[model samples]
Target: MRSVIDIVDLTAAEIDGLIATAEDIIANPAKYSEKCRGKKLATLFFEPSTRTRLSFEAAMYELGGNVLGFASADSSSATKGETVPDTVRVVGCYADIIAMRHPKEGAPLAASMYSPVPIINAGDGGHSHPTQTLADLLTIKREKGRLSDLTVGFCGDLKFGRTVHSLVKALLRYEGIKLVFISPDELRVPDYIRDELESAGADWLETASLEQAMPELDILYMTRVQKERFFNEADYIRLKDSYILTADKMALGKSDMCVLHPLPRVNEIPMEIDEDSRACYFKQVKNGKYMRMALILKLLEVE
Candidate 1:
C-alpha cells in the first residue's frame, strides 16, 4: 500500500496530480460528495490538535467517509503501553486508512511498516508534516498562480517548524525557487536542511531581518515559535516575540505577495493583518480540507 510518511513519499508528479485533483474538487464539489461513501478513516492523534485533526475528519466527511479514533494518547490504548505497530495493525483492520500524529519523531514511519492500509503522517514531533505541506502547495498554486519561480520567505522558528521543513523539501523539486530563512540565530534553519538544500543546488539565503527580505519575496510564510518544542523556558521567552508580522512590517512586501501561515497563531501575526488582501492563511485552512479530500481519494484508489 502507498503511504505518505514524508512529503518525499509522493513524487513531484504525484504532488502535482493531487493539486490538480484538489482544484477540480473545489470547482465541482457536488460531484465528489460521495467519492468515499463506504470507506473508513481512523485518526490516531497522540498529541494535541485543532486544525489537523478536524481537517482530516472534515475531509473524510466531505468525501462521505466515516471517521473513528482518539484525540489524545491518554484516551487511547497507548495509555496501557500499546505499541505503534500494534495500534496501527488493529486500526488497519477497521479503517481503510490512518492519519496519525505522535510526539516522537518517525513514529508514523514505524507504524506504516506494519499497517495494511495507507498511513498519513499528521505530524510527528519536530520531524515531518507532509499533509500540511500539501495544503501549503495547493495554497501557493491557487494564490500565486504557480509554484515555481517564486521567492518564498519563511519567518520564525525554522528549527522546529515541521511544516517549513516539509514545504522546503517539496519546493526543492520545482525550478527557479528561492528560499529566504528569517529567524533568530538560535532558531535558524537546521544544518541538515541547509546541507540538503546545498546538495540539491537550491537557491536560498539566511537573514535575521524579515523586513530586509520582505520586498523580495513572493510568499511570506510565517510560523509561530513553538513553546512546546523548547526545553528552556527562558530561551522561549527571549525568542517568542522575535518576529511578529504587523501591517507596518507587511507594507515592505510586494503588493501582489501572499502571506501564509500554518495556523493557530499565537502572536506571530497580529489579528489586524487578517483584513489585508495578502493574508491567505484562512484560505490555506480551507484548502487543507480540499487537499486532504484529494489525498484520501488518491490513497484509497478511488476514481
Candidate 2:
C-alpha cells in the first residue's frame, strides 16, 4: 500500500532498517533465498538502463520470485501511447509489485497513484532515484563504518545527477556530514538542493576542482555526464570529460577514502584506479542487489 517516489519517502529509521536487512541478507543469503517464493515483480523501464533494471530482476529472482516486464519504451505498451497509469494498472493485476524507470520526471509518481501494488521508483529522469541512494547508503556504511561525521565529495554532473540529489537528501538526515560539491558552474548542484541543505542546517561547499576537494574527502562520489539528459550535443561534449578520476587523482585522497560511481562509466573513472583499495563502486553494485532484495521483501511484506 506504500510507494517510494523519492529517497525522502523513507525516514532515516526506515533506511536504517533496510540497511540492517541488507546486511543480514549479505551475511546469511540462504535465509532470504525463498522469502519471495510465488511472488511476481514487474519492471517497467521506459528508459534505457542496465544496472537498475537487472539489479531489480536479479533481486527478485534471488528471492525465489518470478520477474516480468520490458527493458525499453518500444517494447512496452507506451509506444502505443498507453499512459503510465494505465500500464501499471494492467501490470498491477498480474504482479505483486512494480519497479519503474522513466525518462520523464514524476512518471513513477503518477503510476503510484494508480498502482494497486507497491511502486518502487527505480529512476525518474533527473528527479530522484531512491533505490540507488539505498545502495549508496549501504556502501557508505560498509566502507566508512558510519554515515555521520564524514566529508563526502560529489564530483561531476551535479546538475543532472539524480543519484547525487537523492543521496544528498538522504545524507541530510545524518549528523556531521559535510557535502563538498565538485563541478563547474554549469553543473553545480541545483538551487533546490542548496535551499534544502540550508533548511536542514547541513554544511556544504561548492568547488570546481576535484583534487582540491579530494584531500579533505572521506568519500568521493563520481558521476558521468549523461548525454541523454542533454538537449544539445555541443554542451554534452563540452562537459563530458569534465572530471576524470585517474590513479594520480586517487593518490590525492586519504588512504581510506572510498570512491563511488553510479556507473555506466564513460571515461569519468579510468580503469587504472580500480586496483586501489579505495575504489568501492563495484562493491556498490553488489550492495545494490542486496538493498534491492531487502526493499522487495519489505514492500511485499514477505515476513
Candidate 3:
C-alpha cells in the first residue's frame, strides 16, 4: 500500500533494514537471485536517462524477474494524449511493479494514485531519486564503516542536484551527521534546502571552495554540473570544469575518504583519478546493483 516517492517516505528503521539487506546481498548474492522470479518490472521513462533505466531493468533481471517497458516517452503512447495516471492504470495491469522517471515534477506522484502495482519514482524532474540515495547510503556504510558521525561533502551543482537533495534528507534521519556543501555562487545549495536543514536541526555549512571541505569529509559525493539546468550554456561551460577532481585533489583529503558520483561525467572528475584506491565510484555503481537486489526483495516481500 506504500510507494517510495521520496527518501523521507522511509523511516529510520526501514532505511536501516534496506542498508542491512543491501550488505546481505553483497555477502550472499546467490540467495537473492531468484527472489522475484516470475515478476515483471515495467520501466516507464519519460526522459532519456540510460543509466537509471538500465539500473532498474538490471535490478529486476538480477532478481530473476523480467523487464518490459519503454526507454523514452516518445516511443510510448505517452507522446500522444495519455495521462500519467491513465498510463499507470494501464501499465499496472501488465506489470507487477513500475519504475517511472519523468521530467515533470509530480508525474510519479500522480501515477501512484491509480497504480495497482507498487510505484517507484526513479527521478521525477529535479525532485527526487530515492534509490540513488540508497546507493549513497550503502557506499558510505561500506566505505566508512558507519553512516552516523561522519562528515559528508557534496560538491558541484548542488542547486539542481536531486541526488544530493535526497541524500541530505535521508542522512538527516540518522544521528550525529554533518554536511559540507561546495558549489559556485550561482549554483549554491538552494534556500529551501537550507531551511529544511535548519528546521531539522541538521548541522551544515556552505563554502565555494572544495579544498576547505575536502580535508574534513569522510565521504565526498561529486555531482555533474548539468548544462540543461543552467539558464545559459555559457555559464555552465564556465563553471563545468571548476570542481574537477584529480590526484592532487585527493592528496588534500584523508587517505580513507571515499569519493562518489551519480555518474555520466563531463570532465568534473578526471580519468586519472580513478586509479586512486579510494576512488569508490566504480564500486559504488556495482553496490547499486546489490542495493537494488535487496530492495526488490524487500519491497516485494513486505506484503
Candidate 4:
C-alpha cells in the first residue's frame, strides 16, 4: 500500500501529478463526483483540528464516499488508553483508506505500519503535514502560475510549524526556489531543517524582521505561534506576537506577492489585510480540499 507519512514520501514528479489532478478536479468537479462512491475514508484525528479533518471528510463526500471516525481522542477508544496501531488496524478493516492526525510525532508512521489500507498523515505533532504541503504547492502553482524560480518567505513559529517543514522539503526539489525564514531567535527553524537545506545546497536565509525580507518574497507564508506546542506559557506569550503581518508590512511586499497561511489564524494576521489582493490564505483553504481529494483518489487508486 502507498502511504504518505512525510512530504518526502511523494517525489517531485508525484507532487506535480497530484497538483495537475487537483487543478483538473477544480475545473471539472462533476466528472469526479462519483469516483469513490462505494469507498469509505476513516478520519482518525487524535488531536483538535478544524480544516484538516473537515477537508478530508468534505473531500470524501464530494467524491460520493462515506466518512467515519472520531474528531478527538476523548471520543475514541484512545481515551481509554487504546494504542494508535491497534486503533488503525481495526479502522482499516472497515474503511477503504485512513487519514490520521495525532498529537505524538511519528504516531501516523506507527499506525501506517499496522494499517491494511493506505495511510495519509493529516498532521502529527510538529513533525510533518504532507497533505498541507500538497495544498501549499497547489496554491503556489495557481497563485503564482508556477512553483519554481520564486522566493518564499516563511514567517512565525518555524520551530513548530510542520507545514513549514513539509513545504520547505517539497520546495527544495524545484529550481530557483529561495527560502527566507522570518522568525524570532527562540522560534527559529530547527537545526535539522537547516541541515537538510545545506545538504541539498538550496538557497536559504534567516532573518528576524519580516519587513526586511518582505520585498524580496514572491510568497509570504505566515503561521501562528502555536500555544499548544509550547511547554512554557511565558515563552509563548513573549513570542506569540513576534510577527504580525499588518497593512504597513504588506506594503513592503510586491503587489503581486501572494500571502498564504494554514488557517485558524490568530492575531498574527489582522482582518484588515484580508481585503488585500495579495492575501490568498482563504484560497489556500479551498485549495486544501481539492488537493486532499486528489490525494484520496491517488492513494485509493480510484479512476
Native-vs-model 2 lDDT? Answer: 0.94
User: Distance from true position, residue 66, model 4, in Å?
Assistant: 0.3
Clash pairs (backbone) in predicted model 3: none
| Each prediction's number of clashing residue pairs | 0, 0, 0, 0
lDDT of 4 by residue, 1-303 (tens): 799999999989998999999999999999999999999999999999999999999999999999999999999999788999899999999999999999999999999899999999999998899999999999999989998999999999999999999999999999999999999999899899999999999999999999899999999999999999999999999889998999999999999999999988999999999999999999999999999999999999987
Instruction: Kindly report the root-mean-square deviation of model 2 from the true structure over all alpha carbons.
Output: 0.7
- Model 1 stretches astray by more than 4 angstroms: none
Candidate 4 has its poorest 10 consecutive residues by lDDT at 79-88
- State the lDDT of candidate 2 residue by residue for 74-102, as single tens digits: 99989899999999999999999999999
lDDT of each: 0.95, 0.94, 0.86, 0.94
The regions of model 2 sitting more than 4 angstroms off are: none
Model 1 local distance difference test score: 0.95
Residue-pair clashes, model 1: 0
TM-score of each: 0.99, 0.99, 0.96, 0.99
